[model samples]
Target: MSWWHWLWESEWHGILLGRWMVAVLLLVMGLGLAGLLASLLSRFFYLSLGKTQEDITRRELHRLMRPAWLFAILLAVLYSTLHVLEFFHLSTRWVDWIHRLFQALVLLALGLLGSRLLAVAETILASRYQQANEPYKLQLVHPLFTLGRILLFVLMGFLVLETTLKVNVGPFFTTLGLGGLAVALAAQETLQHFFGALAIFADKPFQLGETIRLENGTVGTIEKIGLRSTQIRTLDGLLLIIPNKRLADSPLENLTRTPRRRVLFRIGLLYNTPETTLQALKSELEESLGQLPFTIEKPLICLTNFQDSALELTVVTFVDPFYRAGNSSTPLSFLEIQDQIAERILRTVRRHQPQTDFAFPTRTLYIQKSSTGLDALSEVSRSGK
Candidate 1:
């Protein structure tokens, strides 16, 4: 016999040369058809949606389409393989296990495809959300997206285990229920922070990039908000990590939310300064503050208190809130505005009265000698004479 005839006639396991060739051809053809169909669908979407080749939607669709094509091809191949085995009378116990293993693989592929689709959906939603101007919504997007991805993975795992592996999850869930208390106790702090993060999303007490003051006297700009903690960059250039639970529970102050900042100035003048000068000083201060670019309105300048050493004049004004950008036409810090106003007040005072002195702590002492002591001194002086 010829070598080819011998090879064709030989059956190493269950399939002969003819059957193996047919199965290979079937698999190849199925995969090729799947690829063609995917391409056609892609072209259809690209044309109908007015999307370019490089558009994100087109790219994501291309990425998602390949796995689906592969999954379909794989299913067809498995079915074909089973049918071939049955026709050849080669269906055995091991073949059944092989079929089950193939089914499991198919299920795994499907799960992966589902995850990809979910990820794509999440990306779209996040993009939409980020385009919105709402600060609270922006803050909630990341945490919610992360949570959705986690849940998607969990569901994928459960579906794979139950449908493909035929594993019973009843006992597993029972064990989890029995150990729920222990698990909760062990993860108490983690749970607290997790729930606290949720509360922060719901309540929106503060947002990223906003200046906040904590009850513990930590003043900083919010850098990041996480499920377990929040990161803040303080004025001192130090990064502060605070637990979400504590941050949410504490008395938090959102300084960025204020429309304007109130600046209080206490100016002390010499006690002996004239009342007319003080009034002039007050008027000058009010006019100067009103002209400042940072000032929101005319200042409230008045004599507020009579100190033991001097008279105190309080100057109150409203200015744009500090450290926030784009809220005002001019970009200036709170300290800078304060310094400019103070310098102007000093210049005005000096111009009005060059010799006017600022108040300092002073005491006037009067010594009154007793009458008897003075008469004795006079007698002593006369005796000496």
Candidate 2:
């Protein structure tokens, strides 16, 4: 006879306060049971997954269990929430709020879990890829993992805003345009650096541990490549941080790419030396360099120039590129190598040919002197005569 009685009698009676309370209690009890079941299922899944030819340990088993267990818990929470909501028919005023709350919570949890999982995955991949020794494939591991995680977080954030909060996505996006533009402007340099890093990764520019020279003449070995800047170890034992944008735009010279470095120089062989000795000099130079382990097989000898006092022999040889391994040997920078080779050639030449002189720039000078006293004496003698 009453409105409450009529409402209770209708098909929508499940949404009443009493029915909702009952549903809540059921949800709680069901979630607890599900949690226990999930724990058991997780252990089973982990054990099954790890069952390979290799031996498995308890610690390894626990490590394997964490991901599946986390995923199962997430699913259980989502399932219980939806079922409870449906039973109470919260398809009305409170539906959006309840859905959003669950969705936001799930997304937050997923973000946390995904980050940890991504990190673990990266570590494993890096170790395996390094051991695999496939240079091209190994390079891609970090980029792929990083991009995947970034996309996941971005998508999660958007879902939380639109689906979870029940916001009109179109209008919200339109409003965000101005804010996004401002952020872009503020971070333009950073964005450039990020893209620059991506370019470096994509184009296979100088990789980590390779020695490179920037256009501005900053030469160093690349220690780390990051989103905005690169860390470099200078020849002088200092660490240099260079912005990625500059690196991307600048001319980069990768010294370590080539197995051997080409060395070119002109050495003077004194013209005063005999024809037979000059012929022998060439053979001697080639033979001596050929004996050195670092020198390349072909020793390039070019008759470059003939000055008044010297016949310049262009000495060109290739040397195996070497990096400083430790403190024992002299750290071989390119300049240092150049100086060493020049010095070695001079020393070797001097040892072989003591009579052969190294040429220097030739110069000639003339001077005239006049005596004022002699001129005056001549004039007085003429006057007396």
Candidate 3:
């Protein structure tokens, strides 16, 4: 017998491909057709997005790349295998089970592929925004992408279970509600944070890139606003992850949103400073503050307090909140501005009264104790020495 005839007619137990060789050939042809379809679809997708093989990225990011093509080809091969079995055993009871299993596997594959595709899209969008220097749009993509992924998996989970396990999703979800009560009981904090996130979005007290201060004295720039928490980059370059619930419930201040920044400080001089020198110092400081481009409105300079060793003059000024010191090519921030202001104050104080000194805390001991107590103190001191 010819080798082809021998192979075709050979039977492994009750199974033979003698007459079903035609079915095998058809199956091969069907797989080829499926592959051709995938190639054409993927090529069309790449071209539609105005991407070419010569692009910076070599990977076919428009989806339906080689892996996806192989994925589809594999599914097609599995499907053909099932049909090939039907050609030989047309009344097999297992055929329906095979079909159901195929459906479930396909759903699983689709879910995973969709998730990766979503991630790819997100990466592409973020890259584009970053290149364009639109960080506001870039930050927005992360949270939105996260939300989309969650919804995708939830929906895909239902479809997969309904197909594979033959579970009725509607009734399952209804029963799940009762079980969810216990789950919710255990995750009350997570739920609170979730709702707080919703509140943040709705109210928009602050946005990404704005500076905010919490009542607990934490100051930082808003970096990310996620479903459960917020990320802040503090001035000292530390990253703080704060729960959304606490952020929403607390008294928060949006520093960047203010119209002006108030600067208040007390300048102390020796108590022996003459009244004329004090008045002159106050007048010049006020004039200097008003002439500054950053400061707004009349500054208040008054003799507010008399400390133990010095007289205190409180200086209050309202500066343009958005001001960045323009003294140099690179503008200075709030801290730098504060340093410069201190220098200016020192110069003014010196220019007004060269001989006057700034005060330091001092104490004078009064030795007018009773003679008996003094004698006892002297005796104790003599003994100690």
Candidate 4:
């Protein structure tokens, strides 16, 4: 035989080592082929993204595609190596065991790849909806994916038990079914909380870091929202934990949604003040308030009522919900703005004091006696003298 033919036909002195080297060479070749195929597939995939190029972000592409390519390469290399080993002279039992081990490894890799792909899909969809301003579009994504992952692992376990360990999976599946039922029964309350969280996500009643006031006057900032419960940081700096069910069912006002705060108050003045002066005072208040920070809207100042003792000037104004004070990035509350307005009102009123006297409850008394009674009193006094 020729030299090349002899090399191909001859098992070297170390037959096992030669077979191992041959398997390794086949594995390397399979890896290269798999890599090339993966690159083509990825290229085609990106090309297919005609209009929806941004559908999968670069980060997501890396997260999903990298794992997929690696999985493919691993499968190809392992499969090629195992198949090559079958061509060699080996004990039947050993070959069978090796095949079973390979099968188990394949099952694990497949399951992991499936789980990761599902996660990538969910993440892409979630981000797409969130970007489109449909915050609730994929509200059920988390719970569903979590459920999917559990099912995948169970299935992988069943496969491994049946194919790798040569065990009966029938009884295990039956047991799983009954156990699942029992678990459902025991976790009823937990399920309720989970569904409640789903509803909250769907409705978007409040968001993290937002201030909300509940029906029962519970005011707090949303710290965290979880499947079982939501945590709130109360105004008093206490952490409040509320079950998701309760929070989703209760009515809550999103304080952060208000663009501005409206304050209405009445300032009473003496009825004796002139009408022109009243008009001037109202105009003055409008001008003064307009000068304050975040007082962009013209204030409403009108004569609202004529009381028993005074004329009431009612003023309604809107102040921006939050304001940065004196070069500080921290926002001062609207309450402080209300206080500042009160000061301005007082100063404006004081400018016209005495003339614009603040009205108070007052009474005037007059004493009178009849002329005949006075004359009779005078006669009695003269007789007594």
Alpha-carbon lDDT, every model: 0.73, 0.68, 0.74, 0.78
- Which lDDT tens digits does candidate 1 get at residues 128-169? 566665656665665676677677667767766787678888
Candidate 1 clashing pairs, residues 3+ apart or interchain: none
Tell me the spans in candidate 1 whose CA falls farther than 4 Å from its real position: 1-18, 26-56, 64-91, 156-166, 322-330, 353-355, 372-385
lDDT of 2 by residue, 44-80 (tens): 6446645331334434544644564556575655556
**Each candidate's TM vs. the true structure?**
0.79, 0.63, 0.69, 0.72
Q: Tell me the tens digit of each residue's lDDT in model 4 across 1-385.
A: 9876666666654355546677888777777677666666666766666655566765455557666677867776776776755535578888888788888888888888788767767877777877876645555567678889889988998899999998998887799899999999999999999899888887788877788988899889888888889999987899999999999988888988888778777987887787778888999999998889878599999999877667888988888766788898767765677889999989998888666857765544334566766522222111010
User: Whose lDDT is greatest here?
Assistant: 4
In candidate 3, how many Å is residue 309 off? 4.1
TM-score of 3: 0.69
The predictions' CA RMSDs to the true structure, in order, are: 7.0, 10.3, 7.4, 8.3
The number of the candidate with the highest TM-score is: 1
Which stretches in model 3 have alpha-carbon errors above 4 Å?
Answer: 1-39, 42-61, 64-70, 81-91, 109-175, 287-300, 306-309, 320-331, 361-385
Backbone clashes in model 2, listed as residue pairs: none
TM-score rank, highest first? 1, 4, 3, 2
The local lDDT score (0 to 100) that residue 228 gets in candidate 2 is: 82
